[model samples]
Target: MSYPDLLSFAAGLLVTGALSGVLAGLLGIGGGGIIVPALALALAAMGYGGDVGQHVAVATSLAIIIPIGLSSARAHDAKGALDRPTFRLWAPVIFVATLAGGISAGLFPGKVLQAVLGFMAFFIAANILLPFLERLMRRVHGSATAQRLCAAVIGYLCALMGTGGGALSVPTLAAFGLPIHTAVGTGAALGVPIALAGTLGFLISGWNAEGLPPLSLGYINLPALVLIGGVASLTAPFGARLAHRLPARTLKKVFAVFLVVVGVSMLWAAFG
Candidate 1:
């Protein structure tokens, strides 16, 4: 790369990394929604070609999310909020389901993958906004059984959406009468499995694709991964601190609204 191109890449990396870090911190997500799209645009702008650009972007974003999730999980653990017993119960189910989802993504066509992402964003937004769903679940709740079921569902959805699982898992747990702090902390832990499984699938599936951009690792773009992952790791603990200090009610409402807007935007991107 020329000096001018290198400079541009550096600028792009910083901007993307900063934006992703802020979103990850504020929302308790691994910033996959923002990172994947930004990466696709950045790669295209940098003159990467072929029909595989978006796939590479998504895969690379997942690869970066592995470390981001680990960092966030650690922060949550420090707060004594993670549900270790519950996590142990659900981890195996989530691992299997996430692997299945990843394989599906890898085997599916590009248009189909895009449509799935669009639909998932909408579904996730609905889950965020509907407090009544939690009430309904609570009406039928039993000891441990309900929580296990919820975890399984959350794991499946998280894999399908290409998220760290916290996007849906945290809220689901909160709805089940788990304190918001515990839910968020436990949800963060789930991200580690999701990222690991999802990244592996992307790498395996994209291994044979040609015309990949420089610094590529299978579908992952190494430069973006390093930049986004590093900054997000640094900022996640701060976000955890903020989560502890802020009122859960306020954060929940704010996060729901944000999900709605982001969902709409993603749908627009997919169909428009």
Candidate 2:
């Protein structure tokens, strides 16, 4: 890339990163909700090849989230909301499931992956909006086993969607009876494993994807990583602080509404 091109890329990346960072901090999400679609659109705008641009965008979004997850996790840990024992217990399963999901995405066609994303969005939205569903699951018995099962399912789905797993993990944990604050905080920590496994999987799977864009690191867009990761890291502490002060019940409901909208948008985009 030329100097002018580099400058322009940096400018765009900074803007993307700034917005992603604020959202990550505010919501305890790794900002994949924004990153995936935005990066896809940005890559296309940068003249990346039509065939592989979306794939690269998805992979790159996961790659960038690694650091963002770490930053958010650390901040949450400091706030005393992270459940170390639970994280330790479930990390291995989440790691493995996420890796599997990443591999599946890499091996699948773009259209298939898009459909998977759409379906995942719908499922996650349902999880958010339907407290009764969780209560029903609990009533079915084996609640402990059910929680682990839900976690595993979320891990796999997050991997497929190129997310940090916060969107599903947080709500699932909360539904399982953990405090909402604890769920969100621990969810941040959980994102680390998901991102680590998912990023590596993407790297391995996309190592030779045809027609890769310039300056790409396997499937990752380096400029986006630098910008988004950097800003998110810096702003996460603020988010942690806000999480403590806010009324968690209200915040959760508001977030659930947001998820529904996002889910519908993804569905429309996929099938429109």
Candidate 3:
């Protein structure tokens, strides 16, 4: 790595760190959802080749989510917003499902994963853009069986897309009649195990994967994980502070738009 390349990589991580931190704080959305594509682009720009760069991005993002999810879950637990019953019920299912997800990821070309991310990004935008879609989501309410199925799907897909559970989980919980706050907090709690299991799966599956950058363990990039965690940790609180003053509707609209662009852009990078 030349000095300029090193500088570019570091700069890329910093930008990813800053934005992810703010979004994590400002929106209940997890940082990894945003980080996956950004880090993919960064890895490509750093001259990494083939699918390995995107694989590293996904794995590293999951690795980064572990601490963030744990901290968030603890904070929500302290507030009594976490629903213990739900956690006990769903966590195991998520773990098993995500382990499956991890295995499945290694079996495919990277474009498939890119498509998953794209679909999720669009799904998120639709849910937010007209919260009415939530009414349809409500139909699945009150079925323990349905929730278990939903949990499996959410866990698998979120892991595949390198997101914490909240993007889809919170809404699902709310549709089941949990209060939004409880949903958010519980979703945060769920993310800890999701990330942990997903991280482990990715680490094992991508071990010695072709074209991974130096110092990578499986798909996880240690430097990106370390640096992003360090910087993003510091900015989350600031984003939280700013969240109090921002108009909720406006902020969500802006975030939704950005997600759409990121999703399409990743797809373009992968397919185009």
User: Candidates ranked by TM-score, best first?
Assistant: 2, 3, 1
Q: What lDDT would each prediction earn against the true structure?
A: 0.70, 0.73, 0.77
Off by over 4 Å in 1: 49-51, 143-153
By lDDT, is 2 or 3 better? 3
TM-score of each: 0.88, 0.89, 0.89
Off by over 4 Å in 3: 78-80, 241-255
- Can you write out model 3's per-residue Cα lDDT over 154-225, one digit (the tens) per residue? 989976788777777876776677766677678877877788888898988998578788889888999999
Candidate 2 lDDT tens digits, 114-136: 56666766676677667765676
> What RMSD does each model have against the real structure?
2.5, 2.4, 2.3
lDDT of each residue in 42-128, candidate 1, tens digit only: 777777733477677767777777777777778878889788976787677777677666655656554454556667666666776
Give residue 262's error in model 2 in angstroms. Answer: 2.7
Error of 2 at 65 (Å): 1.5
What is the Cα-based lDDT of residue 71 in candidate 2? 79
